[model samples]
Every structure is written in C-alpha cells, then in structure tokens.
Target: MSTSFSNLSELVTAVKAATDAILTTEPKEVKRIRTGGLPVGTNNQYFTTWDFVNGMIRDHSTCTWYSLLNTFEDERFSLDQCCALVHRFDYTFSNFLRYSGFQEMAVLAAALTKHLPTAKTREEAVKAVRTFLAYLNRLAAWLFHYFPWNIGKHLTYSYTTASIPTPADPDLSRRVHVADGRKVRLTWQPLGICVVATLATKENPELCEDVLRELPFSIIQDHAVVSGESMYAWAPVVSTAPVHVKERQCDAPVGRIRYSQATGNKIIVQYGRVTEDIETPILGEILLQYRDRLGEVGSAVWKSTFETKQIILLTIETVD
Candidate 1:
C-alpha cells in the first residue's frame, strides 16, 4: 500500500526523514567496509576517512545506488539515489557544481507526491512543489555554505550564468555578459557569500533582459530603471512611490490600457488594442505565470470595444 500526504509540509517531512536515515546509515556502512586506514586511531584518520567517503559518493554508479525513480514511491534509498531525485528539482541552479552531491529538494518533493492526493490535481501539486523547491534551493545553499562540517572540504554555493577564466589582474574578480559586447564586471568581497554584478550596456537596456531572466534569484535592485522594463522577468525592489490601479470602465476606450504588476493577485480585466498578428491567450498566459499564487479564472466577459468596436474587452476574474 502507498502512503498519502495531506499537505506539502507533511510530505516534505516524510521525504526528509527518509533521506536523512539513508545518509546516516550508508556512511557508517561504508566506513566499516574500509577498515584498515592509519591504524584506526591516528590524527590522519579523520581526513583519510572523509576523503574516502566523499570519493565513494562522487564515483557512485548510476545504474544501481545512484539511480532515481521517475516518480517517488514509498521505498528506501541510498545517498546517491536520494541525491539523484533531489538533483532533478535543482533545475534553477543546475549550473552549480555538485561538490556535496545533492540536487533540488523541490523536485524530490514533487516526485514524492506525484501520484498522491496532496493537492486538488497533480499539476497543482507539482506547481506547489516547484515553488517550495525554489525557496529550499536558496535556503539550502546558504545553510550548506555555513554548515559546520567536521571535514576539511568547503562546499561551493555561488552560481553564475556563465564563467570566464581566472583574471590575471587583482582588479578583475569575474566577468559576465548581459549581451554581446556588453560585460558585467563582478567583484567579491573578502569572505563574502554575496555577489555584486554591474552591467555595462548600451543605451538600450533590453540587452540586460535576457541575462536578468536567467538569474536563479527572484529579486534584485536596479538603479534609475523604470518599472515594467522586463515584464516582471525578475522581481524588483519595493518602491515607495504611489501605485495607481487602472481599471477600464465599461464606457472607457479599451485601447488605452496596459498590464500592471501592481494588481498583485487580482485577476486582470484587459481592455486593449491588439494587433491582428497577436493571437496570444491572455488569461492562459497569466495563469501559467502565477500558477502557484492564483487559481483559475473565476469569470470572463467578452464585449466589443467602446471606441471602435473592432476589438474586445477581456474581463478575467480569478479565484483567490
């Protein structure tokens, strides 16, 4: 029989417990298997033992212990197996080296409840899992970097979209590109986990959009940049400026309106002039973008535009 999870929290707890048990047991078993190092009680024992353990973990075979199931079922797993499952979830930060050999915990969470009634539907449950995993990836990176390991290895936690060879100059810390011929110079502070990126682009800031959209982080602050520059590609720092909520009165012309992120979770009633070439499904696009926070469209009304009556007003009300 399969176990059911009432909620994501419950499912996460169970998965974490199982993974922890396996990690604890497998290391001890491996240690016992390789028993003849440095006469058992020497100062070099700690380093030698850790080296062996980490090496075994890295060289683990993918066909057996490191293999991952397509969907998680109620079963025990080895360290590499658990890691394989978690690695799938770490899609956002996949570029980072697997120094510790763990992947996305969120993907693992999604797999664990893939066939369960944890949410109303499998798609909904998966969305929730990915959101939780995004948060978990950030938290885990921070925690792992600071974790007090008895071993001598220091895990690498930072991620970048691209990499360049080590700079010969003391001033050149790292160089990343926002677009062709546009370079962003980065400098790391002493013992700093935080990364500072400064993009040198031309008059057109759209060049930075591609780079911004690929960042693993959710939020960032930009200087002298206008709102909606990237269509919420990355969350911006909160501004103190007054925000105006625009609604199209039935009598008002539909062609004058534009979309706003200021609406928060409210279902959008879009009244605008769309070119014949644009056949985009607005509601569907909105739902896909905010699937975790917003539910389905509660109500939609299509009416002829007040101005020219050529286009239509799409009123999309979403469930909270």
Candidate 2:
C-alpha cells in the first residue's frame, strides 16, 4: 500500500502494521529458492521488500542501520548521503541521544518520500521499501525505549539488578528497574509520609528526590545510585518560626537559656554510613538547623564517623 505519513505516530503505526502482516504470512508464503539468483514471477510467492526488512529486524536484533542501507547503495547514492549528513551535522546516536536520532529519522523519512513512487522494476521497488522500513524500525526503537505501551515480539524489559527488589514478600512486593526512565513513588506506612524520586539515567546523571523525613524534628538526607556512582544530598532543614534574624545584635541577650520556649532536644539523622580504612571514602557535609534556632546548629563538613538513626517500611510504585 502506498501511504504518506504526516507525523511520527502515523509512520510508526504503518511500520508496525506492515511488519505484522509480513511476519504473519512469512511461514506459509515463503519457500526457499534453490540454485537461483532472484525469484521471478510465478516461480515464488509474491513478497514485498518490507518482508525482507521485517525478517532482518526480527532475526538480527542488534544489526546496525548501515547493513539495511546497502539495499539503496549505488553509484549515485542519495539516501546514504542524506543519512550521513544527518549523522554528521545533527548528532550521534547514544543512550542519551534518543530524541535527536528520532528527529533525524523523521528528516530522512521526508527525503525517502522522493524515491517512493518512482520504482519501475521489482528490484528497485524492493530496495526503496527496504530502505524506508529499516529507518522506520530504528525510529520505533527510540520511541519504545521511553514509553513502552505494547511490548511484543522482540521488545522486552531490562533488569537493573540480579534479582527484583522484594524486601518483605517476594510475591507481594514489586520489583523496580531504576536504571530506566521510571519515576518511583515511596509512601511511608503509618506516618503517611510521601516522597517521589526519579532515578538517574545516562542522559541526566543526577538523582532527583522529594523531601523525605521520618519525623519533623529528625534531619533527613537521601542517598541514591547515579551513573554507577553512589551520591547523596541532604534536604534543607526548614525553620518553622514566624521570624528569622540573621546577624547578631550588640544588645542581644548572651549566654541565656530559655527552657520554657524550647520544644525538644535536637535529633541527628544520617544515611549511608562509611567505614574507616587505609584510604577512607570522601563523604560530603550536611548542615543541621535544630528546632528553628540559629544559635543551636551543627555542621559536619569533614568527618570520619556518622550514625544511622532508624529504618522503616515503605511502599514503592512506578509512576508516570
């Protein structure tokens, strides 16, 4: 079928349909030719170039796009030239460069339209369809990496750890792959403290998180895995007082303790403790502001020892 795709959704939909049709009828329609260069009319079942491309996409999951480009390679090369130009000036494909490569595929799709309807011979028609379908497969790969809707055939989920993270019950608790682009929502039981964290990816090498706290008085810091590096950041200790004064006044009350106004004792909270060795690990500092009092504060810039206060159960879920 000769179809003109207006957008990426339309293009991917057409490619999926063509690939499904080709793969479905391949076992029944296809019969290997013996001692022949090309199957002529009535000699073999009629199969389009999309069938060949579908076979390659199914069989060779990790083959490069250049192999498929050979179908269109000739003395006066146009598709390969445009593809090289796109790769050179636009951007290189990598784990981080998904959308840029998808955009490049879209640009190539427009260039491929010029040669679609002009195929005269069977060989030329096969080359034209194969070249177009190959790039469409590449584009679909990028789209599926981020938002996977229908995972069938060759598409599958990748595991981050050796086993799934099932803390309490293996069957009840869920397993999450933070390495992928998944946003995890954690809700602490009993306290109903909710926090969200988007685990780091190759594109964005930073651990993102919301405010996590066991108690309002206890200082909370988050530790996460980012790009194979263990990183941590402390949540800002907010003051609940009405007014805050930065500088000390000349006539201010000095060495005076107000036992009536003080709410409670200062609570120290730390995460990811490090052990002492010949070469100690470099851990960052955390500033603690206790009970909204500027005078009662603590700073641990360079320290060899830290302590873990408590641990609690929490539920994790993959969110949008």
Candidate 3:
C-alpha cells in the first residue's frame, strides 16, 4: 500500500514505524534487509519518494510567479519615465514661449507640438495615436482663440459713381441735376470721424469719392441725428488743389478733387494736392485700386506663403 504525508520528518518516521511493525509481525517472512536503508523493492518504491519531493520543489518555482513580479515592476518604472518626460517637455516649451515673445495661445500651440507624446515603437503605437489626436484638438483651440479674422469669408464693396448734392442752392440745384440716389446717412463720432478722414487721404485713398461724382460734407448735430431724421449743419466741401501763382501773375490749380471707395462701410474724398514724394499716398492708391483685396495684404497672406516656402525648403534641405 502507498502512503502520502506532508512533512519530510513525519513521512520518514511513519515509514520506519510501518516497517518495524511488519518486521515484528512476520519475522520469518521478511526478505534480506539492507543496512541503514529500506530495501529497493519495498512497498513505497524509491521512484515514488524521489518524484514527490522533486515535484513539490518544481511547483514552487513556477514561471507565472516570476512573470507576474516582473510585469508589475516594469509598469511602475514606465509610469515614472512618462511623468518625467511630460514635465521636461513642459518646462522647455515654457522657456521657448518666453524667449519667442509669442502670445499665450501661440505658446501653447508650439509647446504641445514639441511635448506631445508620439509612438517611437510598435509597443506604444496605440498610445501615440491617442496623444496625437489630443494635440490636434489643442492646436485647433489655440488657432481659434488667437486668430479671430476669418480668412475664408472676405467681402469688399466699392461705389463706382455716387452723387452728393451741394447744400440747398435753389438755382444751382435746378441747373445741376443732382442724382437723387438712396441716401445712407451715417453718424461718425469724434474719433470715428478722425479715423475716416485720416484713412481717406492716408492709408486708403480708394475710399475717397470723386468730387464730380459725389460731394461729402460733415454735419454737427445738437442732438444725435438718427438715420431716418435729418437735423444737422453741413460743412463746406474743401478744395483738393493748391492755387499756384505764376511769375506773370497767372493763377493755375495743380490737382483735382476725387471721390473714392474703400472695402468697408465708409466713404472718403481726397481734398489735397498730389506730389512726387508720395510713397504713403501710393499705398493708399493700391488700396483703392485693389479694393477687393483688403484682407489679403497682412498676416494671412504672409503666413500661408511663408509656411509653404519653409516646408519646401526644409524638405529639400533634409533630402540633401
């Protein structure tokens, strides 16, 4: 009969006791006994004891136990590395923002691109994809906040021929058939009027209307004049030409008055002499000439062209 026991000492003692009991009961039936050991072919075989002890030791040292410990340690270390990388990236980006003098939103954008996670290996590919998506969302928000001007929807309108009537001179009004066009009476505040007047001759010359086509005059009101009601004293139309006296006592006008249009909702008329040194005036002329291209002049056009050129140059340099 086979017997099983847990402790080594208990197993050895039980075997000895059973052997002794058998020997005493059947001394004559006992086979030749080996000194200091049980017989090779005893009831509990040599193979059984050796196999049981070895199996218990082997079971204790399983691959699953070591693998579990290793996996846990690796995860803890990876988390620490990830946190350190995130902190370092953030610090570097903040420094960049300070040096670059970028707005808060722009700083955030450039920072995220440099610091945002990316897949360097197949193992973390999924995580990289998720991080990239988050970066895109942040970029979109930054652009919207920083740049309010919509590049896609640009509008420009100009008046080719708009008529303005000279104040109630009954005889002149009858003689000169002033086109009774739709009157769009606009009230300009002190600052607004200054802005319009300055831009009329300076930054945007196209906004000025031709004196022959239309006459523009300012009106001061005791009470604010509503669009529908008309109660104001009109200012006189100023001449745009300089009266020049020739050596022979002859007078000649140098320039002519012209009414022009601008891109936005405003009217301007030139009331000054033209000169050779007029680069600023030339810029104004360009504005009038290309009235349809108002929003195209500044950062929008510059950024698009600059970025495209930079990308191409970078690609070429990299290839080289």
Candidate 4:
C-alpha cells in the first residue's frame, strides 16, 4: 500500500477508481465492522483510516461518509486547497476556455496530471487521492454551471413548495455534500428522465427513435437543509435556445438553447420556494448531474443564497 505510483497513467487509474467508487458500497463488510467482526477496531465508531476507507468503499452510505466529516476536518489543509482551487479556478475560472461537451472529463483529468507529481510516501499518496477527488467534485460542479442546457442533476419529482419533493421514501435515502461550501448541510435528491433525440426526417422519425433509443436526462433537486434549518430556492429555468435565421428571407431560428425538453414549466418558476412554516433563511440552488442510471442522482455544482440575497442563473430539463 506504500508503493509509489510511477507514471501519470497509474495516477489516472487511481483517480478513475476513486470516482467510480463514489456511490458504491458493501453492506456485509460494513456489518462485520459494526458487529466488531474485524480485529482492528471495536466498531465503526473506533474505525482506523483503513477501516473508514473500507466502510466507505463497501457500504458507501451517507452515514459512512458522515464518518469522513472528521477526516476532512483533520485534513483541513488538503480540503482547503481543494476548495480554493475550485473556487478560484473551476467556479470563478474564466469561460474564455472550455472543452467540448464530450471531452469535459478528459480535460479535467488532464489538468491534474500536470502539477501532480508521483507520490514518494504514503502521506503523499493519500494527499493525491484527496486532491484528485476534490478536483473531480469541483469539475462536476462547474459542468452544471457551464452547461445548464446539456447538463442538470436528476430530480425524483418536482416540488413547488417547502414539503419534501418525494415523500418519506427509503429509496431516496442517498445524500452527499455539494462543492460550494456556503457552510451548509447540502443534500441533493438525484433523479433521472429519458428523452429520444434523433436527426431523422419527419418521414422516418419513428425509425430514428427506434434506432437511437431515448436519450438520458438527469435532473437533481436543489432541496436541502442548511445549518439545521429547512432552506429552499427556485429550480433553474431552461428554455430552448433561440433559433435565428441567417437571412431575413429565411424564417429558421438561431441562438436557441439546445435540448428540446424540460421537467417543469419555465413560466411558473416555483421549484424551491420555502415551506409555509418559515419566512426567511439562507438557501442554495444549482444542482449537480451524473452519468449514472436514471433512478440514481449524479453530482453537481449547487448554490445557496444568504438571507434574501439573489441566486445564480441555471436550469433543469424535463422530457418532451
């Protein structure tokens, strides 16, 4: 476990594995830990670093990740570095540069491979894993901000009021912290939808639909509790990009946002209003998206406004 990773390829592999392991877990192993089956520690509460990592990799539950709350606190330096880089570069970074939609992940991975040197010690290796994980998360948030039309997190269902979007469903039990701190308890209820997009002509539209299958749509809800208070913000509105005509005689449209469908009504704009119980509180929006299956919510670049302040401009989609 102390071996140094020699090349950037190995580092990339580690980074990919770390990300792929985000929502994965093993319940049997976690049970073993909790029941004191492991020789190392009494239970998860007394878990060592290895035990903690195993629990996360195995069961990977919110409870397990909650255990990492202390890990992040203890490694505040690395956490801060990760946050600063995202805030300074990823979030506030210039839109002057961008990779094509499909190449986003590749470009993100490429950046780390630059300043990242091969690890010589276990500490260095641990730092690299944390830093790269942070980088992946930060990039994920930025993608939501930069590409609202093409990307948004999955929403289990649209909620117009303070009430939870989905009822007390156990399946919607997964939760994770978003990138932007706002220092709140941010939870994204990930949900997905599917739409069919094809370039076939009207005569062959059905054929094209059959050929390509329905495209995947992910819409994450910005519903969460911040600092022990129920906070809410309106879901972002996404509209079809303006279709412009190159020539006056040509009636075709141009400059419209791409993607034909969306989840909620654009005019209504009532996804995240506070519940009837409260009047005022700090809230966040700007949910995250992942390439995961529809029922699973992906990561995102969520936002929160402080005490009646304004919020960011973003949008989520619904199927046509």
Per-prediction count of colliding residue pairs? 3, 0, 12, 30
Which should have the higher lDDT, number 3 or number 4?
4
lDDT score for residue 91 of model 1: 34
After superposition, the stretches of candidate 4 with alpha carbons farther than 4 Å from their true spots are 1-4, 27-32, 42-115, 118-131, 134-226, 229-320
TM-scores for all candidates: the values are: 0.23, 0.20, 0.15, 0.24
lDDT of 3 by residue, 51-170 (tens): 332232222112211222233235454533543443343344334323322233233323333332332432342232222222222222222122213332354235222332222222
Better of 3 and 4 by TM-score: 4
Q: Is candidate 2 or candidate 3 better by TM-score?
A: 2
lDDT of all predictions: 0.27, 0.29, 0.24, 0.28
Query: Which ranges of candidate 1 are over 4 A from the true structure?
Result: 1-5, 9-117, 135-320
Quantify how close model 3 is to the true structure by its C-alpha RMSD in Å: 41.2
Tens digits of per-residue lDDT for model 4 on 80-165?
Answer: 44433432333212121122121233344344434343444435544543445432332332222222222123433475445454
Task: Give Cα distance to truth, residue 34, candidate 2, Å.
Answer: 21
What is the model-wide C-alpha lDDT for candidate 1? 0.27
lDDT of 1 at 38: 28
Each model's RMSD to truth, in Å?
Answer: 21.9, 23.0, 41.2, 19.3
